[model samples]
Target: MKAKWRIVFLKEFRETMRDKRSLGLLLLFTLMYPVMLGVILNQQIKRATKPEREGIELAVIGAAQAPNLMVQLKQKNISVEQKGPMDEDAITQLLRSRKVVAVLRISDKFAENYQAMRPARVELWFDSAADNGARQRDIEEVLHAYNSSIASARLLAHGVSPATVAPLQLQRYDTGTTAARSAGLIGSILGFLFFPAFICGLSAAVDSTAGERERRSLEVLMSQPARTWELVTGKWLAAGALAVIGITLELFLAHAILSWLPLEEIGMSWRVTTFDLVMVCLASVPLSLFASAVQIAVAMNAKSFKEAQSMLSFVVMLPMIPGIAVSMLELKTALWMYAVPMLSNQTLLREIAKGEAIGALPFVLTFFSAMLPALAAVAFATWRMKSERYVLAV
Candidate 1:
């Protein structure tokens, strides 16, 4: 029986490899994912490392009214362009031009109000629609520092301690590390990394089952002496093997790209080592098998290649629902997450990227989560194929 299945497996595997379209798809997904990921991450790193003041161009009107404020702004590395007094319309045009981050207008009564110990009016004009949030925040910080200095000086002049206004001095300390903060973003990225396992063998699975039936060869194969389980197992392994190869190569290439790039620049880290990646690939092997088994079981029921492809396409996306729902809910990881197939694999990789030392249980759960279902799918397909109805249809 084992020999019969092995012969069937080899035959199907050889036939799948002979199909250029299937092989081309396998290669495309294997290379496309890592290249795209690297490009996106490289762009992010470049953007994050750019100089903070590179775009902080501020236009200040009524510079004479607050000469000291102008000096303070310049000291904070802000590039201030002095402008003559203008109306709100003119200021709006200047901001709309996008040449400057923001405009600062000092009222004409500013100097008089300051000398009289009254609150001076300073209007900050900004385009809220513009992508100058960082620059605008920097300008606001400088203005805040200038105002606080003036208030402290006024309090001292009145012979009162400035500290009297601040009974509570609270200092903020952020305990979140860069890696910890980036875990969520990286988790989303890694969630799609395993998707190729389903995609890589989709064409092969559809063609082997529905395509053969459409071509009238499935009846011939069924007439052979091999039992239903042997034929079904052979086809399942053939498609699953393609998925395995595609996913393994993809993981290795992605690991190389991630390890070479400086993810730390964007407050992210790919802390997975070579050994860890190999172990991950090993654990993920059953995912490919599960995907292929499910595809074969569904596609075998279709009357034509197009119908099978359409049906399995929807089935392919079902695994991603759990991952998406988990992300949307912002749920913390629990032991049960390890039993949820695709979600478990995603969670495992995410925890590994965060440099966590998750022990052997996740690996065990991840393996069996897919393996058991895969065996069940193959069994069902075998039984379905043996049915009198299926025999008559073929």
Candidate 2:
């Protein structure tokens, strides 16, 4: 004897496949989502790898008065555009136009002050609101180093050690690894990859539950010998199967794109191997199932196709909240993160990307966290279907 759920499952699955709109959406997301991710990351890589010394221009109001400063700026790859003496308004307008990063003004008393061994004032004019903070800092660093070099020379000429004036020395050591640097960026990207699981099966779930009821066909299907649980499980499985296939393909395509791109240039990498990828896909199966189960449970309550679609749209967005919260708070990966469905998948992928030895615990937690909720939703949907009010409405 055949299982009644299998009969319904096969029927719904075939119908979903025959639905051009559903299939089209499935195909579109499977191809486009990953390609979009690849394009975004590729742009980041290009930006990161671009030469920093290019495109930095500085305008000097009194260039001839500071020949030594010009040489220093030139050595730091800063192009000096010599300008005649300009008043404050002219310098402010030049900065507002953004043709140069900053304007360097040497006071007329600079040479006299230096000759008398007094303070020589040089002014740096910049627009703080501009997106040139890094460039501005680089220029300021060059000026600071130039000042130190001159101070050291003057002390040496006076038979005094340059170190005599310097009581303490400070140095910076960066202990951050490439993976550490990339964690936030790659983690954010991974969060979005699992969203297709919610989207791919939306049409099928809505159609089988709310769409069927609106067409008056669900009443006939319910009259069959199969129990409510069987019917609900069948529709749930059908929707889940589509989601599974879509998310799995999307992940594989994304993996290929990530592997092909030189993410190392941006200090990021998709370090997951084919074996690791297969494992991740396997673990993610329950996430698709959970999404489909929730869709089926909620969409089944709606009175019409449009109602279900609108309601399910909100349900789809629910999964994104956890992932977005983790990102906004910049939370570190913890075992508890594996208890959340969409967030679990995201955390799992990020851990895999780190190329670290994460044992089976995460995968197990990720799988069951989604699986348990899926089964519960299916149960609730079955209970709802069995209610007298539901049958009366149908």
Candidate 3:
């Protein structure tokens, strides 16, 4: 009803700019993503470069009577413990009880069988159905190694060289350039790191505008000489500004930590070239606009600041749905991926982080698509602001 809304918006914009909480959130948003990504990058780097260790826990009973076999198993990193020879029943129940990952029962006749050149069956008991296939593979490999060593010894007894029995060998050749392999995958994790910072701006925009309305302070604001659009626009831009700060920090942080992590070790570059940063910011515009619109609209519906806070908190949480859904579906950057709002960014951004060329078309389409929802929210919110119930504070 009054031009006071413009004055009110300016006041809020200035007030928010000065407030430490507002400043801190923007700073934290920018830093938070990089921090999160850095932790993951560290973990991945650790995983990729870390020396391999045996995962299966093997308990070898009757190891004393089969000391040769026991020594062979230890060389393969299998954990062996000597015990009285286990009967069939003891071995059976251990697997059922899950007392050990695998039970190695050296048959009581093992020494006799090997000396007689009879096939000695060392029983390995575990539930193949219940355990992971990888574990089974590990167990098989350990046993195979022992068998091969034993076979070589038997061959020596037969007056043959161990090498002569199996002279031929296989070697692996890798054709994948490190960059190609790294670029193919690391972006999604980066995307997860980067997305939530913008959520802070969205939350601020929603709480400040819609929240102000719900608080009845909007009446105080309406008493000044400001246009309704000015109020919305200033706050919207401020929200955008907050979004800009957050995203900029994320990029800088992403760059800073990228150099230290396995991302580079894997041959992917997260360095934000001038062009890359510019494109990232440009892509962020639609995201910020849409996010701001969401918060403002939701906050406007609230009747108190507390109510607005609660609602916007939930709004902050809404992005997780898309984040989780995209990850679970394992959808890559398809044509339709660009059509979805947060998800499109999530997909393409991974490419962006790894210094890959994501087309401008998807970025443009995603921004425009997101604007639809933002506009709808803005329209609904603006209308509510103009209502007798809101304006009259009835």
Which candidate wins on lDDT? 2
Please write out the lDDT profile of model 3 over residues 52-72, one tens digit for every residue: 443456778767657877677
How accurate locally is residue 86 in candidate 1, as Cα lDDT from 0 to 100?
94
lDDT of 1 by residue, 131-243 (tens): 66666788899889899999999999999999999999999998776655666677887888899889987887887788888787888998999999999989999889999
Overall lDDT per candidate, in order of appearance: 0.87, 0.88, 0.67
> Which regions of candidate 2 fall more than 4 Å away from where they truly are?
1-4, 25-53, 96-98, 128-130, 224-227, 260-262, 328-330
- Tens-digit lDDT track of model 2 for 1-394: 8899999999999998888976986798779979998899987766554438355799998788778989999999889999998999999999999899999999888888887888899999999988787788889999999999989989998999999998889998987666656655677877778888998888889889888887889889998899999999899999999999988999999989989999888776566799999999999999999999999999878877898899998889999999889889988889999999999999988887777788999999999999999999999999999876665554
What is the Å distance of residue 351 in model 3 from its true position?
A: 3.2
Candidate 1: residue pairs that collide: none
Error of 1 at 45 (Å): 3.8
RMSD of each: 2.5, 2.9, 6.4
Q: How do all the candidates rank in terms of TM-score, highest first?
A: 1, 2, 3
Where does candidate 1 stray beyond 4 Å?
Answer: 51-55, 392-394
